[model samples]
Target chain A: MVLKDILSIIFISLGAFFMFIGSLGLIRLPDFYSRAHATGKVDTLAIILVIFGLVIYEGFSVNSAKLIIIITFVALTNPTATNALARAAYRFRLRPWFKKDKSKKIKKKMNWEIEIVLFICLLIAAFVSLYVKNLLTAVITLSVFSFFTALIYIAMGAIDVGFTEAVVGAGVTGVLLIITIYRTSRRSSD
Target chain B: MHMFFIYVSVILSVIIFIPLYRVVTGPTIYDRVLCSGSIATSSMVLILMVGVIFNRIDMFIDIAMAYSCLNFIGVIVFAKYLGTLGSRRKNGT
Candidate 1:
């Protein structure tokens, strides 16, 4: 019993350490692709480790079986989601950030310029979406705004609300807006 | 042992801010998507740890599993929808 307890502690702590490292990489990495690589692979492994430790602590039981099922589900879905996101981004023409480019200086300047514009636009879009004449643009801006709000909810430890926000607010709403735009006129009169 | 779980949960919660920063400042929409995915995963683990702290693993495990499924579906939908936007634009229809 003591041996099992010790092993579980070791595994859980190791998992936490990896989780920290993965989040660190997510922040410190320079580009979208690298950040995806960090979160997609490392975070999956970390969750699996932590769950395995919990399973060991629980010993043989129905709950342990459930934990195993959760592990399998996460392992399967995480990579698929990551792949889909990357493919979509690639299709959308978002270039990967490379470290050693010949035109590094020019790229750096452009990066700052675009970052500032996007930051300002993100703030403006929130308020502007409320009063925008065009419904489609308003929907797009609202989705962007909701994405940030979802992150805030998660950080606040409201995981259930965050999950709902991510799915309904960002996912379903975006799809519904697209369908609406397809059906109605693209432009709106104020 | 319960105290250990509580401490670990607190540590995990603090670790979440790292990815939150990325989500807020990510260069592209995809980066934000990735960071949010990471945050979701962390929350799942944190939920499980909370279950441990409260000695209610049975209930929380189900919630965690459902949350994971929802997160996966959300990401897949976003990707599929966004991926086709480019092709549709080029086809001009």
Candidate 2:
């Protein structure tokens, strides 16, 4: 029992570490494609590790069985989602930012100071999405907002609400908005 | 075990903001999508951890499963729609 507990702790911590690294990479990476690479591959592995740790902690039970099912679901869907998003972006003609792209304009660099700062940044993104001139960027920003909201819900112990947000908010809403942009215009005035 | 789950959850919640930073400041639409996708994936793990903390793993597992399916379908639909749009633009229809 002690050994099992120790193993679970080790695995869970490792998972959390990788998850942090993945998110860090999301912020530090240079381009869209590179950011996708960071989030998609690393986050997938982190989730698997975390879930696997939980399965071990629970031992062999109906709950662990369910967790295994979730593992399968996540493992299958994550890459597919990443692939789809990448393909969609490519199809939309959104160019990946490259180091030597001379046409790229300079923008203000983001500094990581505090967690509250991150939350404030999220609020800013939400407002920017509302006011951005590009409809596609607006939709993408909304998707980001939805995802963060889902995380907040989960942290508050509202797992069901978070799940709903994850599915409907981040998932369905993003796709619907993209479809709207496709049928209409990619740019917005003000 | 429960305590460990809580600590991990807190860590994950804190880390969520890093991706949010990307979403906010990302230069392109794809960067936002990718960042959000990362956030979604992490949320899935956090959901299961919450399940462990509350001692209700059974219910949350179902939610996680359904969430994954929805996420997958959403991405595929968006990609397919955009791909069709690109082709339509090319065909001049």
Q: List each candidate's DockQ score.
A: 0.40, 0.57
TM-score, candidate 2, chain B alone: 0.85
- lDDT string, candidate 1, A1-190, tens digits: 4988888999899999999889888877778878788888999899999999999999999999999999999999998999999888888777877676332111111222212433443464477568755554455557655654554454455656855776787668866776766556544332
Report clashes for each candidate as comma-separated counts: 0, 0
User: Can you tell me the DockQ of model 1?
Assistant: 0.40
Q: Which window of 10 residues has the lowest lDDT sum in candidate 2 chain A?
A: A101-110
Worst 10 residues of 1 chain A by lDDT: A103-112
Task: Extract clashing residue pairs from model 2.
Answer: none
Fraction of native Cα contacts reproduced by each candidate? 0.55, 0.74
User: In DockQ terms, which candidate is top?
Assistant: 2
